[model samples]
Target: MMERPVRKHVRLKHYDYNQNGGYFITICTRGRIPLFREGDRLSAAGMIARACAEEISNHFPEIVVDLYCIMPDHVHFLFMAVGTPYMASVRSNPTISKVVQQYKAAVSRRIGRPVWQRSFYDHIIRNPTDLEETRRYIAQNPLKRMNSNG
Candidate 1:
């Protein structure tokens, strides 16, 4: 089920993106194809994915890099609300949502096409243990992408 970068057709949902917590999020391409998977190797799409991963590192100076990975089709992040957020939180908040929207905007601008799904998945980190584990997962995602046996 793959398509082009969808427009902001769907209504945005409510989310709690701030509130002093760590977050683990995964975003996919339009549909669920391997936009990130290419052969037994990474594709140029992977570079696009990398662009996404490098985002927080290169975003509004306030953006911080907790942990992240860019798969051929999806991206994961273990980021936190450092200082003030990108956008304020709404009932169906667009704080983290804005992060995702910005990611899509950048990808689209770079690829000359929309390269992300209309929405993303996010989970606020609950504890230190889960936080560490999630970070490890994000860090190891590249190896998993590179190795079938990994």
Candidate 2:
């Protein structure tokens, strides 16, 4: 039998119209923590996580943020890209992934520890079906968290 070449899962390459640049990203802490404690206030870790997400948005001007939810352990975001998808040309440009790296690095500096996982979970939203499903997931993540907390 002949051996097949191993393939890398190049994100946008797998999708049809990589130019349709809307992404919903989910980022989580290295260890899932109800980092917020004591009062009903966000803990130091929680604040750091939020700052990371905000930095990602600030760094990636191409990404237009539509919505976001900053939780104790993870962050959710919905954003659209203004130009070609990050993969279209790799155009010697800083893409969403690089922005995320910057966010993670800054956060690690703030905490004096590695805070985030290396890679994030992202999905390209195409039509109404995908959009609605993603929105619903983002909307209900809080309820899911509350249930888990209880």
Candidate 3:
């Protein structure tokens, strides 16, 4: 009988994800299929993904979508979790995983198909320098892709 390979755990152990902090996240399409770009422009699916990402803050008040870029097969974004008293009163604890899952689900529902891979990649922003670098990376991702493609 063949055995399945074990997937490595990607999240930081014992870290409080719901605490106030910034997170850099990357989510890719299933099979790394390029479904979000076309000739330097975003496809319909990409637009939906963008809209959904933008609405994440509305759905989860504790989260603020700082910056985001949608590429052909993946997306990169930075979000800040600023805890709200109202959220605490409501007994809602929003985390990075929950936010990403909701965003993916919204995009998939709007597109009428499953479009995301099982899990996402994340980096916890440790300081001002890291945050600035992450912002630059997200801002420059499209240009990098354009240069590489052209």
Maximum-lDDT candidate: 3
By the TM-score metric, which is better: model 1 or model 3?
3
Models ranked on lDDT: 3, 2, 1
Clashing pairs in 3: none
Predicted candidate 3 versus true structure: per-residue lDDT over 10-91, tens digit per residue: 9999998888889999999999999998878889999998899889988988888899999999999899998753353565
Q: How much does each candidate deviate from the true structure in C-alpha RMSD? A: 6.0, 5.6, 1.9
**TM-scores of all candidate predictions against the true structure:** 0.70, 0.71, 0.93
Error of 3 at 12 (Å): 0.3
Comparison by lDDT, 2 against 3, better one = 3
Q: Residue 137 in model 3: shift from native, Å?
A: 0.5
Candidate of highest TM-score: 3
Tens-digit per-residue lDDT, 1-150, candidate 1: 888775663332554554445768898888766776576565777776666668654664444668777676787887776655334473322366676678778777777777777677777778889888888888887787568755
Q: Candidate 2 at residue 12, lDDT? A: 65
TM-score of 2: 0.71
Sliding window of 10 residues with minimal summed lDDT for model 1: 85-94
Name the 10 consecutive residues with the lowest summed lDDT in model 3. 84-93
Clashes of each: 5, 0, 0
> Any runs in candidate 3 off by more than 4 Å, and if so which?
85-92
